[model samples]
Target: MTTDLVERVRHRLAGESRGTDPIALAEAVRAEAGGALSHDAVLAAVRQARDEFVGAGPLAPLLEDDTITDVLVTAPDEVWTDGPLGLSQTTIRFPDEDAVRRLAQRLALAAGRRLDDAQPYVDGWLPARQGRIRVHAVLPPIAANGTCLSLRVLRPVTHDLAALQAHGCIDATALSILQAILKHRLAFLVTGGTGAGKTTLLSALLGAVAPTERIVCVEDAGELRPTHPQFVSLVARPANVEGAGAVELPELVRQALRMRPDRLVVGEVRGAEVCSLLNAMNTGHDGGACPLTELIRVFLQVRRVAASFPCHAFSG
Candidate 1:
């Protein structure tokens, strides 16, 4: 049913205006795709296509809005956003759950990922400005309802110390303290809740790194954009639809280590990869760093009394 709707929508869109008026297009699609699906479903399908081709579908306007920081969709008819004014709902509505599912699948595909009933959920990034638009979507059973979507707009890494201070994210004293920490090349972690400017601050500080030093970053997704003159990055990959060719964060850390970086950075310290990273840092990789948004347990199992639980036993 969805495949047929998508085909018809695509055919209709070929002749439609290039303008980004979703409502007008939705009305036209409803007229063209008469009885194809319900009225709402046809509109949803059109919006989904619009998201793929013109805007982010139902979300193009909100995403383009400079004030909005987050977009959330709980159901086809429901949309909410967080901006300078905080969380609020919009009049915009999706056609139906199927339309929502199609948008989700389209976003996942944009990030070179697959999302379907088999996968149930997807977490990826969309290439949008310096704002790293992180996409997370989930389908039924796991979702217990319609597809749920969460989009976060990450700040660009072009910010500097002055920029951070201007935004009131740090004070002069705090700036001095942070600079001292970085000047000494001390390994450290920054913690914060959602929307707390953690990534923004980190990006600015990374820009402050001495030019003579080389930096290598490993992350689940490629979100960091440090202004360092010499920097390399390795992004973790998930198994494809065939469950093959997966490159995990831990392994990427190991690869980064061999790159001879003066500083190692873990975009986020999650999973068993933490063990590999910790072992590496404990075994002379002192200048490693990560941003801890939430505390996850790190199991440091003490091995038998005889064998030392050294870096030898670990493998990313």
Candidate 2:
């Protein structure tokens, strides 16, 4: 019945009938086909179909607003956006939790992903109809309150180092320091809290490297976007429902080492790969770095190993 309804709507939309309201078209089709579709049902079905076809939702307009950084959905009726000014509630609603779930599932499936009670949660990038989609969803049991969603939109273009310097993410001195660090091939760590501009700083720093050099970046979530020419990126994956296969971050790090990378970048080290990264740096893979805490762990671990190895020491 759903498939037939969808086909009918598609035909109506494709026919370009003048002065026909889409909801009305859907209702007429539903009545002709003897399907139980109300005005609200027709409206919802049309919106879903349109979003699936075009890849953008009604929220697409708000998502395109450059001033907004985050879109928070507390419930179908409550929506809020955060930006430089502050948080301001928007006039967007889902009608109910089921509507929200349907929209979430449609968007997820359109992105070649899944979202449902069994999985209950999803976190990944969504290819937007007009822009990028960073979506997170939580379902019941795990989410006793209800399913929650947060969407972050990435700008179509990225900023360069000079631009960042202008924004105070880095000053001239810090920029020069980073250049020297990259030039001397010294291994350094970039530390900061979440949303503290770690990846952005790393990307800008990587951009300063000589274009002739090859950089291999391994990430679990694939967030780093470097501007350098000779760059290779490897993203890790989780196991499927059947548990057939999975590619982990540590494994990717190990693999990147073998790819003859002039510089190895691991985006946000969070696991046993710390040992491998330290080994790589200690073994002459200079310019190795990750997020600050990971770097500190690596530094402390390296120092501990050095103290134990006796002959192993880092020379200034």
Candidate 3:
């Protein structure tokens, strides 16, 4: 299909039956742009229109691919994906940079965030219908090049200790050690870099907790999925453009403290929330867990170890 035809179809379809009926809309668009497009190209054009205006546009297919763990849009012509085999580029492309910008802005809005020149970047977790994507979008001033959208596919992988062992996320020795940590009620942190299976590992460990134990998890994006029956989760919320309502992790940590939690879980420690979490730990909130990005900095502040501790930390 020609660009002119696609544009014409998009313009006409922007009304009443745009996304509600893709099939009928596609048929109508194909008829409207007839004679010029080849028989095979007509169907392609139809599907393209459906993808463009009706759905997530170019990103629906990528999001549907279970193997793809991430989708990176560096530019309109440049799209990359990271799967089990690792990062690689794909053939997905938009008409221009503006299309990418529109898609990014729509995703942010769909997730109840505001993104524009005033706020060049946004960070939030999409609803389940949007594939539960963790979104971080940047515009020209902050991005240098153009609009860039980074989406992390948070697939449901709340595995148990044995499942982690089966998937090689942890060796048998590590699994045994992790179970011992839970059994003994030792307070420890999961120190690892991004995409290092830190959240996956921590979720598995939380699953091993006793059913009777009450666990509360505070996160920026609600990434952790614990199998424990009594798991309670709280996610941070960003303030609007007016800057009236904003809820941070530290406040959630304080809120979780008064709820009589047997164990507390923080998805990541980024700021004063760490101080509150540490204070709670010192006050005997044992078996708490958090992913510390800078493993070195965390250890540098640990002045001493237990006189006769039974567990050792694992680093990878």
Candidate 4:
């Protein structure tokens, strides 16, 4: 049967033949079988043998390791991983630069992007193995040393509001203040330095919203996952290889406004879109909220305007 033929070929290839030619191996197997298979069948068996050998590469096992948060490769021989403790060296090695280049190209292609000498660098999220892959690579004169690669592995969500409270991210007074802000539909911003739990506070406030009202979120990295019934999420996209197609957060914000959102949330405001957001808030979009940096800027702008003129004159 064809199944038995396939298995026989696999078994023969699995042995330590030490770089035996596939055609020679197949011909030997056919000769022992009393010429049962034709020449074309032997060639087909040889091709399958070669494919099975190369397809059993080691990338799958490395990706499956949960503790490995990142994978780094400066060259084919140098591989490393960064996890909970810190960066540790890895045993995984590629045969040569060509091998590393091939794997990088495959990963980039799988992520719907391209990688090559012309476009020697790429950054994107790739859905492969166990978790998402954040790939960055540099080649040749730009790299100086050699081709470099870094991958960031993202884990699943596991924490909730109670957990955040336990970590002192929110106190009773702060919690109450957030609730009042949400309840009264007052526009507010939660500001903090990097890694200061800005997104965490935003997620908690969004979680406090009424389940019936619709909430639209626009983000660049798709990190905000608010626990609400009526929620819609949109993520932006970078330009393609040709630099023709791209979708940005501001465009998504404009589209989200047209969707009749009861509440609008932007994950981060770092560009001209702040002007659009300010216009929206000042023009009856009361409940809109963003991070604290923006909130402080608006507050300072208002304070400067008040200080510039007399109180009675401002009232008039």
Number of the top TM-score candidate: 3
Error of 4 at 69 (Å): 3.7
TM-score attained by model 1: 0.78
Tens digits of per-residue lDDT, candidate 1, 1-316, equal: 2556556656666667445477666765675667566867766666566665553677878887878888999998889999888889999887678777878888888867789988898887888864668899999989997799988876555789888899887899999998988887777776777667777777787889899999898887676788889989798877776778899987988898899888888888757677667666666665667887765343222133114454443222
State each model's C-alpha RMSD to the native: 5.8, 5.4, 4.8, 9.4
Worst lDDT 10-window in candidate 3: 307-316
TM-score of each: 0.78, 0.77, 0.83, 0.67
By lDDT rank, best first, the candidates go 3, 1, 2, 4
Residue lDDT tens for model 3, 28-120: 676677666676777787777666555467887888898988899999899999999999999999878877887888888877788998988
Off by over 4 Å in 1: 1-55, 296-316
Sorted on TM-score, best first, the list reads 3, 1, 2, 4
Worst 10 residues of 1 by lDDT: 297-306
- The alpha-carbon lDDT assigned to residue 122 of candidate 1 equals 88
For residues 37-60, write the lDDT of model 2, one tens digit per residue. 776766766666554345445567
Candidate 4 lDDT, 109-220, residue by residue in tens: 6666778878888887776545456677766667777778777765433355666778887777877776788888877766878546687778877877889889888877
Screening candidate 1 with a backbone cut-off below 3 angstroms (N, C-alpha, C), the clashing residue pairs are 51-56, 51-57
Candidate 2 — worst ten consecutive residues by lDDT sum? Answer: 307-316
- Which pairs of residues have clashing backbones in candidate 2? 76-94, 191-292
Error of 2 at 110 (Å): 3.9
